[model samples]
Target: MLTLSLILLPIIAGLITLAVKGETAKTVAVVSAFAELALGAYLYSSFVPDATSQFSVSYDWIHSAGIKFSVGVDGISLILVFLTTLMVPFIILSTFGNNYKNASTLFALILFMQAALVGVFTAKDAFLFYFFFEAALIPVYFIAAIWGGENRIKVTFKFFVYTIFGSLFMLLALVYLYLLTPGTHTADISALYQAARVLDVETQSYLFGAFFIAFAIKMPLFPFHTWQPDTYEEAPTAGTMLLSGIMLKMGVYGLIRFVLPIVPLGVDKWGFVAIILSVTGIVYGSIIAIQQKDMKRLIAYSSFAHVGLMSAGIFSRNIDGIQGALIQMLAHGINVVGLFFIVEIIQQRTQSRELSRLGGITQSTPNLTVYFIILMLGSVALPLTNGFVGEFLLLKGVYEYNVWIGAVAGLTIILGAVYMLRMVQKSMFGVTSGITEGFADLTFNEKIVLFPLSFLVIALGVAPNIFLKVTEPAVSQLLSIIK
Candidate 1:
């Protein structure tokens, strides 16, 4: 019931929001998100640390094919669930003073997105996971097309088509896996894992590649990443935030949950190819980012770079690599959201995000500059920042696997700092430009959005142990399976 409520609350709130008007609608959305957050917190507080299945709920849905309406959390899912719940309310609050033309519909979409994402993480059955996975894309597509910047329609179409094409292949792969299930047959992920163990290496390789292609496109890694920059630049700030911050993690999460453990031999066989692609993406993204004048596009490329490192870590096939990738997923999500918010705030105030056209922001808006600098540092992986811990662990994990791979990937740290610092120098320092001279500091509402994120950036950096502790057991169990 608790699991069901987590999935249902947002949907109910979305319907209620449509009937509401003006401030009342925003209030209703806020209250709904807050209540959902409260429930997520309760789940976290009551979670049994050593339990294999915590807060689980399962029911028979289709017995003939052996599918069940199953949901549960171990530590890994719990942390991500908490992140999703916590961030949604903050995202709602962040929109407080904005003129979101159709407030009710916009808020409703957000709530719907919330419900779908929760379903994605909580689902234990493969068919249920696929259902939620595809379902989550609908509201986001609407959000981008309806409220986004110029060129939204084309960008949204490309984004939708690119991901859907990849996912369709994954769905086909799932069906293939289902057909191979033994005895009573099941789509439960655990049952699938057991079945995968006995499958021949050739079959596992095909299934792994099918799933990998889907997740890679979703992560928008390198060669498959052509659609991302336009989509990020054209989408509304909030939609971009949700996409970069949360949606991308679905790919990383899928890799950890479904790919690595279930097809260890396949991963072992092709992991090097993944590592090479990730390294190439890191370099490719950074080089492109340095040349971009558009702030949104720059950040979009930077996002590609960050997630590239995460992919490398996932392919490292070691405990540290997997654990680091998980931590990086959360850290990257929070940091990207904060970075995009800053972009939005700047655009809102200055009417532009072109680095060449803006100057001397620090002289006019010191407070906003301070926050921006911190976020930049986080992006560059400054020591004692959340970015540092994840990168360090990821690199260390890579080194443990292969010294040459680690050496090549390590260039990202320097390259990341170079582009990020260059962006800061160009955008924030120097004589005030006409556009920046009249710039205003962060409004109260903006501060409400940034403060908590910044705090987490530092807090998690200084004491990542809190999050690491939550993920360790699950990661260990996963690693044990691969071994």
Candidate 2:
């Protein structure tokens, strides 16, 4: 099936890359990633945009236990799959500027991570979903721990431990629901959904806690987010891309797929509490970002705030909220990768990311300055940029949920602009600092990554319905399920 090819091609290519030597592996990986992206685009074109799952592939994997190796894409899964396939080639190509040691192994890990991520997005069986969910952590763990900074070992470990702990709860929740299935027990997601929906409000509340803690930790919301800034600051740029750009989406996607439908009663009971955490995180992360000096760490905090808004929108439980969250997920992924890529180029060229040391880059590298400004505008949700449409709808969704909560959450718009504009002023304007005096303009490889991203920021903003249309039916289906 086309869906299977979408998930498996990178896996085979990654295995092939492991045997390659030198930069050849990186080349192979990049080409294969581009191929994967093309396949994903084809899948998107072919997808019907209906509520029903399409291009399904299923078979018995463990007959006695009623386990199955099943996967498919509905409109719900389609957009996330498109995001995964679309972002990865760029993620791979962005690394062409660096020649990491053991390049084969490094690139292979990325491809492996890609394969696992596709699996997470596509898996239709409960245990199958959990398998891919946890599988993604392994390659990223090595990517961070082995290739990261002086504190990489400890920080990556903490990140690994935190995520794994959360997943244990998900594993328990899935198995509990699996056992609850009527007749012969099974791990099919549809069956699990039905079984879960019929539970009493009290029981669903407990189940919600289990799934919510896991997804909340993955989204790394608020108090559960201590490990993120450190890990992002220390990991390789490519690894940071993986975490912020894609892996975090696993949590948001899980909330839409598993938590909301299976535990609607629980959502009705405690969705307000979830909204509180998300909104608090939005305000809390924005305020903290205002104080950070390191560019990557600041962006890390900014990423937290942006994700908080998306999370708030998702928990808002309206058509606008869910659709906005979906659209914002794609926009945020693109903008964050561009932001981090800019930071990586700066650090690579000047060996520093501190604002005090970074002024006036525009004096010498006006082109890069332009690129950074566009990406920053995208991050701040400037009108006609990709961020604007999503943020607008998200705010509308939350406001509809409760005017007071939406008003609190709306502070993100103002604070986001303040800190982001501060970053632009301190880093790009005025006289060139000593470190930036000899700054080179954007490289060909750098252009390879930023140009397309810049174009996407504008194009998607002008016509967001290209994404929204495919997702509307599915989101409507989800809303009906929640009822």
Candidate 3:
């Protein structure tokens, strides 16, 4: 029941919010998010580290077709659930002062998004996972289409079409796997995992490719990443944060939890090709980010760069690489949320996100600049910041797998710093632009949003062991399965 609440609370809240009016709706949304967060923390506190699948709740949903409404978490899913619950409240609070006309609708959509994402992480059956996986897209599409900037229709459609096309392949792969199950079998992920492992090598490779393509497109790696920049640039800031900070990690998580484990031999066979593409994305994304003039687009490209490294780390097929990828996923989620929120603050004050048109924000908004710098440092992987720990671990993991691959991919650190610092230098320092000369410092509410994020960035950097300890045992279990 507790496990079910983790998925149901937001959904229930969303329905209630849909009926509320004005500021009351926002209040309802925040309260619901807080309640959800409290529940997540409780779950985290009680979680048994060594338990194979903790806090599970299962019920027969479509037993005729061998599907069940099963949901549970191991260490990996638990941490992600906590992250999602923790962040959604902030996402809601961040909207506290905005003047979107359809505040209730927006809050409702965010809550809906929260529900679907929780479902994605908790789902134990492959069919249930696919249902939630596709369901997560609808709220985000509404967010972009309804609350986005001009040109949103085109961007959201492109985003929709690109991801859905890839997802079709995944659906096909799932159906194929379902067919392979022994008589009167199930879509329980564990069952599928066992079934997938016994399949012939050729079959495994084909299925792996299908799953990989779906996840990769969601991760928006390299050539498939074209939809991201426009989508990020045009979507509302809260929407962008949700997409970059939390949603993108879903793809990486899928790769770790679904693609790699179920198709270990396939991954071992085609892992190098994946690594090459990831490294290329890292280099390509960074170079393009350096040339971007729109701050949102720059961050979008940076997202691609970070996820590239994450994907590469996962494909390295070592404990360090996979563990680092997990850490990086959490760190990236928090840091990117902060970064995009900073972009939001800038846009709110200056009515623009253009780098060339904005400058010298520090002259009037020193406090905002300070927070921006910290987030920038986090994005650049500065030491003693959350970003540093994950990137360091990822590189170390990759180096252990292959020194050359590590060296090539590690250039993202330097390039990331170059572009991020340049963004800070150009926008926060130097002469005050006409547009930004009168900019205001962060409001009290904005401070509420940013301070915790900044503190976490540094705290996690200094004490990543806190998270690593929780995740390591489960990651080890995964690696043991593959071995």
For model 2, residues 349-464, the per-residue Cα lDDT tens digits are: 99999999988888878778888999899989999999998999999999999999999999999999988899889888878888988888899889989999989999989999
Each prediction's RMSD to truth? 1.4, 0.8, 1.0
TM-score-wise, the better of 1 and 2 is 2
- Clash pairs, candidate 3, are none
Off by over 4 Å in 1: none
User: TM-score of every model?
Assistant: 0.97, 0.99, 0.98
In terms of lDDT, the best-performing candidate is 2
lDDT of 2: 0.92
Which residue pairs does candidate 2 place in steric collision?
none
| Top candidate when judged by TM-score against the true structure | 2
Range of the 10 consecutive residues with the lowest summed lDDT in candidate 1: 46-55
Off by over 4 Å in 3: none
Instruction: Give the 10-residue window scoring lowest on summed lDDT in candidate 2.
Output: 358-367
Q: How are the candidates ranked when ordered by lDDT, highest leading?
A: 2, 3, 1
